[model samples]
Target: MLVFILNAGSSSLKYQLMNPIIKKVFASGICERIGIDGVLKHEYSEDKELKLDIAMPTHKEAIEAVLSTLTSGEGKVIDSINDIEAIGHRAVHGGEEFSASILVNDRVIETMKKLIPLAPLHNPANILGMEICQELMPGKPNVAVFDTAFHQTMPDYAYMYALPYDQYTKHGIRKYGFHGTSHFFVSNEARQMLDRKHNTRIIVCHLGNGSSVSAVHDGKCIDTSMGLTPVQGLMMGTRSGDVGAGALQYMMHQENMTIEEALDIMNKKSGILGISGKSSDLREVLEGMQNGDERCRLAVDMVAYNIKKYVGSYVAALDGVDALCFTGGIGENAALIREKVCAGLDAMGLVLDPVKNNKRSKVARDIATNGSASRIFVIPTNEEYVIANDTFKVVTESR
Candidate 1:
């Protein structure tokens, strides 16, 4: 079946048309700058690409433009809208209500609406995309593939905080790890690469602009670094990860800052940017480090240090990891970060082969030395494929 996957953000909509059964993306592109001056860059194939700059005052117009382009003769990806068997949406926060991807219905939509406070920056855009798809493709099955779904396997102890019991039971505040999709995809790929028969313990480090580490024991998520929100884990491109509560309170009192003001600084101005007082992008930070910038070097060291700490903690959590997989933009491409993270980890049997680690490849492969006890792999994640496959399964099973 042809599944159209949509990952709608505050100002952009990324889409991919794929046949999950065949594992092929027939077409993919993105609609950027929505609600401002919109630009649609659609690629039906490598040789067939289309770019249109037009006004998309609302998400409805953006979706309409995408459909129009997909079916248009000049940039036709599908013969008609009917050719799309199902639509899959990337929902950021499902809270505790959704443990897995489900077919979108009135009840699901309502529950998602109730979750707006949990994912203020993401769920609304996702809901808008789903609602528009429902309107345009009335009877077609629309699936909601949540980013939080895969980590729902986390036990109560791992997900729960040490706060008053009433906070969790009443306010539903607890760890709901983000990037569950990416972690899930990469872990499964790691499992395949390891070629293990019995239950395998895996630690997946998803490093990108936002980073997280997950301990997956036998394909189940036991614990993840991200907690309550995406900002609680590793030091990210901008988000301050794992800041002390006392420090925040101190800042508020000292600066006479409101909660919102303090959070704006934590979520936007902190991390590598705050540390280096330079570009948040790792590429630039690496450049600055090469130029003898102490702050940039510190930023890189902090990131590597945090990741190494998580790896050590998760190793204990998993009792001993069988394989370690690195994914996401930084994880897959930044060899220096990987090398730094793996440094001194030889005691844990994760000995990175410098030659293998330095080599870049599109496919998933091990970077561990031949004699290492634990395997280390670089697996590129495919979240869209996971969404498409989940959507296909849900839709097919419903029928």
Candidate 2:
């Protein structure tokens, strides 16, 4: 079946057209800077890449452009849009109503609207994409695979805050971790690579511009670092990870700053970028570290330290963890960070083979030393595939 998966942002639309039955990505690309000078980049697996300069004033325009690309002779992956069996979307938040992917319907659309306050930056955009597709493909089936759904399994104790109980019950104000889709995909893939069953305990580290760690026990999320919002986890490229609750109040009082002002600092001007006073990109941090920049070295060390601390915390949460899997841009590509994080884990019976760890961009492989009790792996995440699979399941099951 031809499944088109979309991940819509405030000003961008990334899409993948895939024949899920054959597991082949026919065409994939993104439209960037919508409502401004736009860029359309499309790629076909047959070594064909197209870059177009166009005016995509809205997501509707972007969708129309994408449809044109699919039917065009230059990059035609299929005969017509009718060949698309279904459309899947990466909905960033589902509030408390959706626990899994669901076929798009009027009720789903309404629920998505109600979720806007919970995800002001994402849900509105997602709704826009959905509405555009509904107009463009009248009766076509569309699915919303939420990023928050996979984390719904978190128990009350794990997701709750110390705030007044009524706040949570009234406003749905509990932890709803982000990147659930990526964490879910990588955890499942890691289990398969380990030749183990779903019930095995695993810690999936999803590190990138945005990052989080999940503890999967019995194939369900037991705990995750992110809470209520994406800004609560391990230090991200721009977001300050976890911080003392009192700091916000103190900063506001001392500087006469508003909550929004403090939030702007926490969300945009923090993490490695804030500490290093350099670039947020890991590659740039590494370069500065190699050039003997103490601040850059400190930034790198801090990120690694935060990851290791989470690993230890997950171990305790699970009582004992079976595997530690790394996935995402930094997790899959940063060998230096991996080496540093695994340095003192030997006390926890987790050891890495330096030789194996040194190999860059290797696929899922065991990197643990001979005598380690736990295994460590590097598994790249495929959230798009997860959305596709969920979309296929929902559509087919309904039929």
Candidate 1 lDDT, 338-364, residue by residue in tens: 999999999999999999999989998
Model 1, which residues run further than 4 Å from truth? none
Candidate 2 lDDT over 294-321, as tens digits, reads 9999999999999999999999999888
- Colliding residue pairs in candidate 1: none
lDDT of each: 0.93, 0.90
TM-scores for the candidates: 0.98, 0.98
Once model 2 is optimally superposed onto the true structure by TM-score, how far is the C-alpha of residue 355 displaced, in angstroms? Answer: 1.0
TM-score of 1: 0.98
Q: Residue 68: error of model 1 in Å?
A: 1.3
Model 2 lDDT, residue 362, Cα: 58
Which has the greatest lDDT? Answer: 1
